[model samples]
Target chain A: MIDNIEIIGLIAGILTTSAFVPQVYKTWKSKSAESLSLTMYLVFFVGIVLWLIYGISINSLAMIFANAVTGFLALLLIFFKLRFK
Target chain B: MIDNIEIIGLIAGILTTSAFVPQVYKTWKSKSAESLSLTMYLVFFVGIVLWLIYGISINSLAMIFANAVTGFLALLLIFFKLRFK
Candidate 1:
């Protein structure tokens, strides 16, 4: 049986990953990223990449899935940041 | 003895948790969050809280520690978002 904590983690992962979707959508439609800090997001992207590697190393389904989607979103934000700036 | 996977998790956790600090600092100094999507962060905050709870339930020290710090940073961002806007 799957553990309860993992379930909770999955739910939390979904919520957090979905959180980025709106940011991507807004940035895409609004075509603005003036308030975003480039350094902050660049660091964040690196962090996400590390999480992805760690997740893969540990064979964590939740971690891998969450980081993959979140990483994609972070990339999108980065794209918006560069394009809009 | 601490296993390698957990070590990776710890390193990944620290990197991600610290990612928010720069964002908080930038937002604080800039006194603006216009480019940030409010809905995204609102959902993200709730997600972080869930991660904290899940971490506690699982007795995962790394998750608990990481989420606690990230949650604080997220709160600060939310505060800045509200105050600056």
Candidate 2:
């Protein structure tokens, strides 16, 4: 069973991952990404992919889960940037 | 010494953490946060703070380094949001 720290990590993972939800929603609704930084998101997407690979290697549930979800969110943001452009 | 995977994790950490530099720079230059989502950044900041604590508990250099940097960037974003307002 996961201990307290891992549990803390898990909760942190959940918060960070879910943090993207509102962003995606707002961007989707607005269909305007003028203020969003494409370069930042592109670099960040690559970074999350690396983090995902790293997470898999380490087998940390929190890392894996958080990066996986964050990766998707980054992709969605990129998609919104492209579509809105 | 750190192994291959941890090194990969470290690189990922640097990339993701640095991803915000361009954003912070652009925001600082423009001094406009209209399209930026305050909710997302605020939530993300709290999450990263938890991540910092969790990383310290686990003694994971990658996590600690990443979250520490990302947390600073997130705060910068929030500060821009408020200041630009």
Per-model TM-score of chain B: 0.90, 0.93
After superposition, the stretches of candidate 2 with alpha carbons farther than 4 Å from their true spots are: none
Model 1 root mean square deviation, Cα atoms: 1.8
Candidate 2 residue lDDT tens string, B47-83: 9999899878977788889999999999999999999
Chain A vs. true chain A, TM-score per candidate?
Answer: 0.90, 0.92
Q: What is the DockQ of candidate 1?
A: 0.66
Cα deviation at A53, candidate 1, in Å, is 3.0
Write down the lDDT of every candidate, Cα atoms only: 0.80, 0.89
Q: What residue pairs are clashing in model 1?
A: none
Error of 2 at B77 (Å): 0.5
How well is each residue in B1-85 modelled by candidate 1, as lDDT tens digits? 3577667667767878877877777787888898778888889989989988976885656667878888888888878888899
